[model samples]
Target: MRRVGREEPRAGRAVLPLSLTLVSGILDAVSFLGLGHVFVANMTGNVVVLGMALGGSPDFSTPGCLVALAGFVAGTVVSGRLAGAVPRPPVPALVVESVLLVAATAVAFAGLTPGRRFAAIGLLGLAMGLRTASIRLAGVSDITTTVITSTLAALGARSALAGGDGAGWGRRLGAVLLLLAGAGGGAWLILRWGPGVALVAATGIQAATGGAYAYLSRRRP
Candidate 1:
């Protein structure tokens, strides 16, 4: 019974991060496909796009990328501070993220005017930044929620094929698959209904994840 009790909470720790990763994928799809070729969650992609824009690529927007990058930085700073001050950082940080996502969804529903597009990009970027920082503070191993490059590298590096005992491969693989699934589903929804619908779905997921995390945290001993 004691071992089972400890293992259950350990298992529960992965839930919030995985759910947030799915939200990241959906937001990335919406921003890249619907917004002006920008990535709100994936800063690595945003940086590359920013460079391309600087290199005179008409397909990307320098200002939009800059806004997202700036927003992400701001969110990280804010959440880092919040994490330092609070006992349970993920709860409040997730609340802030949810609010930002809701605001972004509203901006999307209104219209994607040039101004509104930038606003949505910044809001989504900020929300994702908060999520990244909060999850880092939560100390969940093997999941980053927003980016999965390292997760993939670690998965391959420590696999049995690499002459090492394969540990954590399942969770790493699941993260990769969920990211792919979220992107594909989000893209399909955007194509069929529009970015507004996809944003709504993402926001709902974030809100629900936050609620679930809070509930589970309370239940944990």
Candidate 2:
């Protein structure tokens, strides 16, 4: 395994990306269901919504989608800078992501009026953007945390039917399942309690994931 400061080889690891994929699903569900039908994690969906809105879809908000896209780009830039500055462990980026999620949770509890709801969406988008960028910088594989289209393609290409040994199936399948689980759980929380509860759960999980990574790094010999 390769090591770089506090960072260890994360490629081919299922646990971290699986957990982060779960986080993505939770945030995306909350963003879509609770925050004006926006998508914070999935920019492709957001862009599609923007196009639809421009094509006269009353169900979508063009401004909201644009705001989310902009926020995501900003978050990516910020995360890139953070990673370059730290260049060792990824704890700083993860902590910043958690902070963004926490802010979103606070916005949810504060009530989603006109401005506040959009603010929450932006925050969620920013957090997800940061996470995706950080993961890419860390050189992980078989998981992008938010996007699964490529992962699905990879799985299909390497399946037994495709004359391949089905390598990396566990991580690929686990990512998809975890994402589904997180989305279901987020939706249930939104229906049973409210957005506040779901956001809090997502934030808590994100923080816990970061802490766990940090702990594991310290234990590495």
Candidate 3:
């Protein structure tokens, strides 16, 4: 019974990271497809795109990628400070992220002029950075809530077929699937309605995830 009680809290904690992964996917899709062919959440992709842009690719924007990378870095710095100041780092970090997402959504609704597009990209990149840093501070294992390359690698390397114990396979698989689902849903919504609608949806999911995490933290002993 005691073990079950302990396990329940761990399970509850997993929900927040997984939900954030979905949020990252939606934001990445929206940014890459609608904004300026850059990734806000997945900085790895953003870096590669930036390199491509530097190499004279007309399909990418150098300025947009740079802004996103800078914004993400700034957000991580802010998150580190926030984590040190607050007893519960994730709560405050998530609150800030949610606020930034809301602002990004508002900007998206306003218009996607060249200037506003960069603004939205920077805002999203910053928010994702905050989320990533907070999750790191929380020490959640096997879920990154953003890039899944490492997760995929670990999944393949640790699979029973590879003569290794399938530890963390479930969470890794779920992260991949959720990220895929979020990206697909985000792209569909962008095509059907607009990027603004997609940002609105992403903002709602982010806010809900923050709220759920806060509630769960409060309930945990």
Candidate 4:
């Protein structure tokens, strides 16, 4: 149990959210560059693009991103429904996110010719949103999974006021760094090879995370 004014146990359980954030970054980068300058993982960026599109910006498209956002909402709905039935964050999250990944894998496999940009973008966005909502409901604080601004802000505040102990600053810092790593690597993979490679990598990472959570749950019992 957490005190009203105190931070939760960041050293152990809190690490779970960061892992999902890393997954978010990778998928975001892949969707951004490969999916026609749209974002599946980071809705903030997608919303920004949406606004620009409405403002008649040449670089962004209004309809394309709206589709991604809709898919994301659908994905979130799916995740929320799963949560309602299970009522456990970690296990339910794993189940929902793994299903999203299966959807993503199916899209990737279906679009293996490397040309169905819209299909990939839509599927990727839905998968990411579903996975993100699961993490958000896990009751993590200081990390939003899909959004980095608050995470960075929290890291700064904690690192500065760390005083003597720093109160789990390492984990927060690790979250930021892991997100960067995911984005950078995802971008690199997409640019060098193709969306297929990045999708594969993202799928593998999430699958492993699900496996880890399941293993930990078993051990706890």
Q: Report the number of the highest-lDDT candidate.
A: 1
lDDT of 4 by residue, 96-209 (tens): 666766676676666644345666666776776676676566554556677787767667666746544466677677888888999999899888888668877878877787
Candidate 1 lDDT, tens digit per residue, 133-177?
777766755588899999999998999999878988888898999
Residue 150 in candidate 4, Cα distance off native in Å = 1.3
Report the C-alpha displacement of residue 199, candidate 1, in angstroms: 0.5
Off by more than 4 A, model 3: 1-9
Higher-lDDT candidate among 1 and 3? Answer: 1
Model 2 alpha-carbon drift over 4 Å, by segment? 1-12
State model 3's lDDT.
0.86
The lDDT of model 4 is 0.70
Put down candidate 3 lDDT per residue, 1-221, tens digits, no spaces.
00111222465467987898898889999999999799999999999999999999999999999999999998889888886777677888889999999899999988889999989989998998888877776675457799999999999999999988998888899999999999999999999998889888988988998887777766763
How many clashing residue pairs are found in candidate 1?
A: 0
Deviation in Å, model 3, residue 216 alpha carbon: 0.7
Taking all chains together, the TM-score of candidate 4 against the true structure is 0.83
lDDT of 2 at 174: 87
TM-score of each: 0.94, 0.93, 0.94, 0.83
Give the TM-score (vs. native) of candidate 1: 0.94
Each candidate's clash count: 0, 0, 0, 0
What does the lDDT come to for candidate 1? Answer: 0.86
Model 1 misplacement above 4 A: 1-8
What are the lDDT figures for the candidates, one per model?
0.86, 0.82, 0.86, 0.70
